[model samples]
Target: MGADDKTQNNAEKLGGKVQEGLGKATGNKDMEAEGQKDQSKADLKNAGENIKDAFKGK
Candidate 1:
């Protein structure tokens, strides 16, 4: 994946982690679920980029 894409994905994952932590600490199930969703989305995007790179023989 490109540097920018990787960085962005990492940031998203980190943000999600923070959100999840805060949600758990405050007992907010919705925020925790949202954070998990964000992390999942970032992971899916990163996986897509990896697949594209593989197809391109990078």
Candidate 2:
């Protein structure tokens, strides 16, 4: 993946982790779920980028 995309994904994943931790500490199930969703989205985007890069032989 490009540098910007990778950076954005990493930032999103980190943010999600923080959110998840905060939610768990505060006992907020909805916030925890949202964090999990954010992480999943970041992971999926990374995976897609990897696939594209592979196809391009990069």
Candidate 3:
């Protein structure tokens, strides 16, 4: 994957983690769920990127 894509994915993951932490601390179920969703999306994106890279023989 490209460096920019990787960096953005990592940043998203980190932001999700922070959101999850804050949500838990504040007892907000919706925010926590949103954070979980965000993390899942980032994971999916990274997986897609990896598959693309593999197909490209990288």
Among the numbered candidates, top lDDT falls to 1
Query: Tens digits of per-residue lDDT for model 2 on 1-58?
Result: 3768978998899899999999999999999999999999999988988888889888
User: How many Å off is the CA of 23 in candidate 3?
Assistant: 0.4
lDDT of 1 by residue, 1-58 (tens): 3768978998999999999999999999999999999899899989988888888888
Overall lDDT per candidate, in order of appearance: 0.90, 0.89, 0.87
Candidate 3 similarity to native, TM-score: 0.92
Model 3: how far is 53 from its true place, Å?
0.6
TM-score each candidate.
0.90, 0.92, 0.92
lDDT of 3: 0.87
Model 3: per-residue lDDT, tens digit, 1-58?
3667877998998899899989999999898888888888988888988888889889
Error of 1 at 48 (Å): 0.5
**Which stretches in model 2 have alpha-carbon errors above 4 Å?**
none
Rank order by lDDT, top first? 1, 2, 3
The per-candidate count of clashes, in order, stands at 0, 0, 0
TM-score of 1: 0.90
In model 3, residue pairs whose N, Cα or C atoms come closer than 3 Å (at least 3 residues apart or on different chains), thus clashing, are none
